[model samples]
Target: MLESLKFFILRFDRRRRFFRTLAPAQRILDIGCGTGKNVTEIQRLFPSLEFHGVDLLQDSQVPPFVQYKRVDLEDGALPYPDEYFDAILVVHVLEHLHRPLRLGSEIHRVLKKGGRVYVETPNWISLFIPSLAVDRSQMQTINFFDDHTHVKPWSRQGLYAYLGACCHLEVEKVGTVRNWLRLPGDPFVILAGLVIPNRGNVASAIWNLTGWRIYGVGKKSTH
Candidate 1:
């Protein structure tokens, strides 16, 4: 559709960077997998790797090859042995947790030695980002607290510490999450919003322009 084309040209997607962080692993676990977008994306990117997913609810959308478990991230433990996964993804999951560190501990417990874990969440800037839409109900959330599910926000430094101190993982970061190939479209998207703002796309594009998300890659220590 025409709208879909506009969204692609406008909205910034961070999947490419996240995928690169997970590329080195053979076995991957996605915490808070939701309805299996992570599973589908990973499968499309690297079909040879083993994939597992855990979520608060059941998902029927995933392929047969994926191992899935339903878990309450705060109440129930991640039911995997220590150092089990080669790479783990906690994309947009931590902000929803009441006890995020509990999951972080489990992430460290399940991740293989020297294996990578990629965590992405909204930064403090998410608290103030305004939606471009005139009718607010039509817009996807631009502010972090707009999603009542989000318990807290994460900064680049805070995420770095969360992985290092709580999880005992060696952490790495590059500040904000962005894709160079798509970044050139940001200014045009911002300008387009003034005349013909696609509410959903413009909000997401604005967030990317403002660096609303913070992320880090942590590797479980070998010794």
Candidate 2:
């Protein structure tokens, strides 16, 4: 039951929404794909679309028609020709980059003009919310640095600026997602929503302020 609930929350996450948006792309690349889990799910929905996954670790259970490449992104350039992919999914991957600009340039190079690039990163605000954390220690640390490898924790605005500056991509959508309800704080929000008129919007705004993930969708410049 707990796992089911988690899946329900995941379905509404920004990454899943980004996945849905690119269902029609003829070719999709999943960078830092980590076993092609996301792409495998996407293939279940759109099986005809070609999928490619690149990660440092090899996946043992890869699906058919999906190409998996074990590439050390830190050491070398991605092995695709310029403008090779129709869409690129960078979900929860940017923060791990040591040279985000170099990879950003490569992403821009491999994606066709007018193609979409979906980026989802941890919201800086989530560090302040304990319910968003997995343990007491994480809450105390309060920076989502539990992994220690998350070198870049971006806000929605930061995501927009980085993509615009580095990749020269056109920003199409920027917002928060997985703005789930918390314990004490959300109960009050729910109460306010029930008692006051148009206060639901206010409550929603509050939750968005504390949302867990910052999401961005950008288009490769047609020029």
* Alpha-carbon RMSD, each predicted model: 3.5, 7.4
lDDT of 1 by residue, 39-83 (tens): 787787788889888886755755577798878888637999988
Residue 208 Cα positional deviation in candidate 2, in Å, after optimal superposition: 8.6
Which candidate number has the best TM-score?
Answer: 1
Least accurate 10 contiguous residues by lDDT in model 2: 132-141
Residue lDDT tens for model 2, 1-223? 9798757655665667677777669999988888678898788778889999888775675555678888777753789999999998888888788877778888888999889988887888755654322233322223467557777678888899878887789999888775443333555654564455344333344444457577888899888
Clashing pairs in 2: none
